[model samples]
Target: MKAAKPLPPYLVRRYQGWKATTYSENSTWYKHLANEGQHPRAMVISCCDSRVHVTSIFGADTGEFFIHRNIANLVPGYEPDGAQHGTSAAVEYAVTALKVAHLIVLGHSSCGGVAGCMAMCSGHAPELLEKSSFVGRWMDILKPGYEKVKDEPDPETRQRMLEKEAVLTSLNNLMDFPFVREAVEAQSLSLHGLWTEIGAGALEYYDPAKGGFYPV
Candidate 1:
């Protein structure tokens, strides 16, 4: 077998050029950010998918948004853990330290993890569900959505539907945290659910008026 070719030197040079441009363009903000620390206005919970970067899509600048990513952007009902909860820890810091005014739970179409959750609903082995590992247990958080939509006519189509429904489900679960609930009640914070389709490059926002998601 032939060894793989190395990346072109031109590509590396272009990245270096862009890095210089970014530093020059964002010098003031970067300087202040380094000194003052991050005080993001919102916190974003999104998937770990490389295609679904929240900052790039939203045109966010440095220190503007506190973000946490995991398999399928799950919030696990605010567990009282002895160790650290990465997602919850980011949320707590965003709320308390940054005084974030919004918490957005972002889900997207064509998510592999969502498909995995759907697969679990299709009668996987007991040992698979009993693994007690991170991904397996995290998928359990979206079980209600999977179960609710499992009996649909087509498994593939239902999986897609469940992906969107799971976003709403997780948003509802965010309120299970007392701090999140209090912030909402006081009108100091708000929660939002968003869905994006990677293939079409279209975005959707949850519309409370219609009680459904609509393209933005």
Candidate 2:
């Protein structure tokens, strides 16, 4: 493979500083993790948004959470067809191999992917309608979620509703995986849905019994 371009000076300096300070301070723990392998208790699937910090929010240390970040934090319905499915592969590893006790789907407010799905479904983003658009194809997972909130009269409310729907949709889709279902039925694994208010640092959790998200 061709040599990759060097990182920007600012980022290189930042990494050097981290290596001199944080890495030195936690060198022992880092080495232990490398040698022992990870045994994270929970697997957190969250959005790729830069603002969402899963470790900071949970006060978790390295090796505590197996995290997977993707646009809109979606989990597609199970399809056994042979294909390259990054999310499914990660889920399989986390559940079947790692045996994580908890699977958390973490969504957040002001999600771009959710907004894009809303726009595409509302006939606003014509470019996303093209078959070759990767984001369009990925956001298709959340299209059903848009349908649930499209009827809401207020645009802001609709957008917020869809954000929460993204969490619920992922939670439901988790069960579509046979291994996930088996784990749940065996009471070995549990699923949760969470949504965060990015600016306010507030979190809400989904309640299956109530069929709504409640502040946490």
TM-score of 1: 0.87
Query: In TM-score terms, which candidate is top?
Result: 2
Query: Which parts of model 2 are misplaced by more than 4 Å?
Result: none
Candidate 1 Cα errors over 4 Å, as ranges = 1-15, 124-127, 130-132
Q: lDDT for each of the candidates?
A: 0.84, 0.95
lDDT (10s digit) by residue, model 2, range 14-90: 99999999889999999999999999999999999999999999999989999999999999999989999999999
Candidate maximizing lDDT: 2
Candidate 2 scores a C-alpha RMSD against the true structure in Å of: 0.9
lDDT of 1 at 164: 82
Candidate 1 weakest ten by summed lDDT: 119-128
lDDT of 1 by residue, 141-198 (tens): 8888887788899866887788787788878878887888888999999999899988
Which residue pairs in candidate 2 have backbone atoms (N, alpha carbon, C) closer than 3 angstroms, thus clashing?
none
